[model samples]
Target: MLKTALFGLAAATQAIALATIQAKGSKLFTSDGNQFYIKGIAYQLTEDDPLAQGDQCKLDATLMKTLGANSIRVYHVDPTADHDACMSAFSDAGIYAWIDVDTFSTYILPDNPEWNETMYDAYASVIDAFHNYDNVAGFYVGNEVLTTGASSIAAPYVKAAARDMKAYRDSKGYRSIPVGYSAADIADLRPNLQNYLACGSNSSESLDFFALNAYEWCGQSDFETSGYTFLQQNASDYNIPIYFSETGCNTPKPRTFDDQAAILGSDMADSWSGAIIYEWIQEANDYGLISYGPSAAATATNAVGGYTRSGTPTPISPDFDNLSNHWKTLTPSGVSMSAYNPSASAPSCPAFTSGNWLVSGNVPLPTLGDAFKASGSSSGSSSGTSSGTVSASPSSSRAGTGGSSASAAPSSTGEAAAATSSAAAMRNGVPVIAQWAVWLGGR
Candidate 1:
C-alpha cells in the first residue's frame, strides 16, 4: 500500500510539471514559450461516462500516443465529473485537451442561443472542472453554433459568452485559458463569420482564435480546388489565430487523408495552425478512424445515420494507419513564439453590406446578465452540478437542431453531378447538406 502511494505521488508530481499552453497573437505557446501546433483527434466516448472513465481514458491515451497525437478535442463534457484522473492521464501521456463548454441540447441552442446568467453559470462550471489540469489547452465557447446564414444572429451571443468566460477567468485569477468558437463550413458565410469574430479590439469581445469544421477537401484535391486558398485570402488580415476545428472528409471510403500534408505543411502553415481529425472512434456517421476497443466488433450496424458497433474490443481502421503514417512524416512549424506582435490592434469589423451575410460592422455585445450576479460564483466557488454518474444519452456526431425536423444533406459522391441534382436530392447525405438539414429540421 505504501509503495503504491509513493508511485502515485511521483506520477502526480510529473503530471503537475507538464507545460501549460497560452495564446499569443495568432499562435499558441507552451509555458516554456515554444510554439505549439495541434496534431489532434476528436474523442467522444458517448457510451461511457467521462467522469467515471479514467481507466478508459488511459486506454484511449495509450493508442493516441502510438498515433503521435498531441491533442484531443471533446465536444461535450459532463461539468459535474472530477476530471483530474483522466486529465492527468492525458497530461502524463503528453496529450492536451481542447474542450467545449456547452451541451448538445439545453445549454446554448443554436437557433435561439441565450447568453444569460444560466449559460454563464454553466460555462463557469466547465472552467472549474478542468482549469487545474496543466494540459487543458483551451475551451471552445460554442461549436458550429453559427453554422448557417440564419444562425448568424447567434454571433453576438457567442461573443458575449466568450467575453464573460474571459472575465470569469480573470476574476478567479486563473491562467489565461484561450476561449474561441468552432464554426460550420458554410461556403457563403464562412469568411464573414471569421472576420466578425476577430474584428473587435476589446479583449473581452474578441476571440482568441477561430475554427471551422471544414470538409471541402474531398478525394484527390488541391489547395485552390479545395477552397483553402480562398480561405487564406479572406482571413489574411484577421488578428486572431485560425484553424480547422474539425476536418477529414468521409465521402471516399478508405480515406487517404491527404489533407494532413497541406494542413501541417509549409505552404499553408502561415495561414493555419494544425487541424484535429473529425473523430477517433467509429460511430454511425462512418467518420471514425478506429473502432472503440482493441478488437473488431462482430456486428457493426450502419443504421440511424451512423455506424453502430455491438461486441467487445473495437478495431482500428486502415484510415488510422494511413493517417498515422502521414503524421509521422509531417513536421509542424517551429516558428518562434516571440515573433508575434502582441500589441497589434484587431482589424475593424466587416461592414454590414446589402446582400452579404455579415451583421452590422459594430454589433453591440451582450452583457453578463443579472441572474448570474445573484446566484453564481466566480470567486472560486463550485458551479456545475456534480453528478457522479453518466446521466445523458450518447450524442450523435450529427447533432439535431434545437426544435425542428430538417432537410437531408447531399447524398451523392460526384460533386458536379450532385450540384446539378435537385436541391432536395442534394440535401440527403452530403456533409454540407447535413449541416443545413440539421438546421432546417430544427426550424
Candidate 2:
C-alpha cells in the first residue's frame, strides 16, 4: 500500500499543469472558461508507440511550438508503455494530445466491422493509461471507420465504441476526456454520419465531438471553391464541436495551406473549432512539413522505413515556412465560455437510406452484450480466441490503427471474459485493479 501510494505521488508530480480542454455545445473550452481551438498537427511516425521515445517527442514538440501549434493528434500509442516523458514534454510546451484509442489489431474495419469485447478492452485500456494526464485533449474511438457510403453499416459499431469508451472513462472516475470519431469525409455520407453520431437523446451514448479528414481545399483554393462553404453550411447548427482530423493537400506542390487562414479566420472559426494538419513526419504521402534525416537521404518512398527519426530534425522547405507564416498571422479569439450560451439542439438522427446510410435511426445502437456479439462473429457465441487483450509488449511491425489490419479470431463469452482477462493484465508492474486504486488514492 505504501509503494502504491508513492507511485501515485510520483505520477501526480510528473503531470504538467495544462488546462483540460472540454467540449461544450459546439465549442471547446479551457479550464478557465475560454473557448479553445485546436491548432494541431498529426504526430505519428512509426506504427508502434510514437510517444514512447522521449527524446524524439521533445524534438518534435520543440518544432511544433515554433509552428505555433497548441495540440497534436497521435494516431496510435501503446497503452501499457509509460508515456510520462512525452506527455510531460508536450504539456510543458503548452501542447495537448488528442490520442486515438484503437490500435492496428483492435479497430473496427468498415467492410467487416465488430464492436466486440477485445475492442472494448483495448479502448478502455488506452483511456486508463492516459486519463491521468492533464494535457490529454481527447480520445478518438476510431478513425475513418466508415470510409465509403457502402460501408455505412458499420456505423452502429462505431457509435457503440464511443458509448463504451465514454462509459469506461466515467466508470474509472477519470476526467471527462472527450471521446469522439474521425470520418473520411464522403460526399454521400455527409451530414448523415455527422448527425447520426451527435443526434441521439442519450448524451452519454453520443459523441463528445466529431472530426472530418477533409482535404477538399487544394492549392490556392477559396472557401466556396474548396467546398468548405458547403461544409460550414451543413455543420452550422451542429450541437457538438467539430474540426478537421486531417487536412493539407499536396498535389499542387509547395502546399500553401490556405485552408489554415479560412479555418482560423471569421468564415469558419465561429462554426468550427479548428483543424489538425495531415501529419508531422515527411512520410511517403509527401504531406510532411518536416523530414527526419538529411535532405539528401530523405526518400520519397516509405519515409518511415528510410529516414532516420533520431538526431536533429530538418524542416521540409517552403511547406514548413508556409504553415508557420499562416499560423503566425491568423489568430482566432473565440467567445468566453462564461458569457457563451449554447442554444443549438442536437440534430435529428439521419434516416437510413439504402446504399447510402444503412443504420436506421429507429434502431438502438449495438450494445456490447446484446445485439452486438463479443467476437464480432456471425454466430451468437465466440470461438474463445478473441480475448481482446493487447500484448504487454507493443508491436513495431503492425500498421497504424487508422488503416486496416488482419482481424482477430473470435472470442467466447465476449465482454465478461475479455474484461476479466484485461483486468488481470499487468501494467507497469502493477495489476490494473491496483493501479486504479493508486489512481483513486491520488484523487
Cα-based TM-score, every candidate: 0.77, 0.82
Best by lDDT: 2
Give the worst 10-residue stretch by lDDT in candidate 1: 413-422
Tell me the number of clashing residue pairs for each predicted model: 21, 1
lDDT of 1 by residue, 412-438 (tens): 111111001011111134311111111
Superposed Cα RMSD, model 1: 11.6
- The true-versus-predicted C-alpha distance at residue 264 of model 1, in Å, is 0.8
Error of 1 at 76 (Å): 1.0
Cα deviation at 89, candidate 2, in Å, is 0.8
- Which clashing pairs does model 2 show? 118-388
Whole-structure CA lDDT of model 2: 0.71
lDDT of each: 0.63, 0.71
Over the stretch 1-443, how does candidate 2's per-residue lDDT look in tens digits? 00011364363343345788899899999988889988899887666688888888988889899989999988778888878778878987899999999875666656545555666878898888888788899999877666566567667768888988888888888889899998876777868989988987889878999998777888879999989999999889999999998778776888899999889998999999999986677644456678777533435453444555455668888999999999999888899998999999988877767567766673567655322232324543222223332321111222333332111211111111121211223336653221100001111
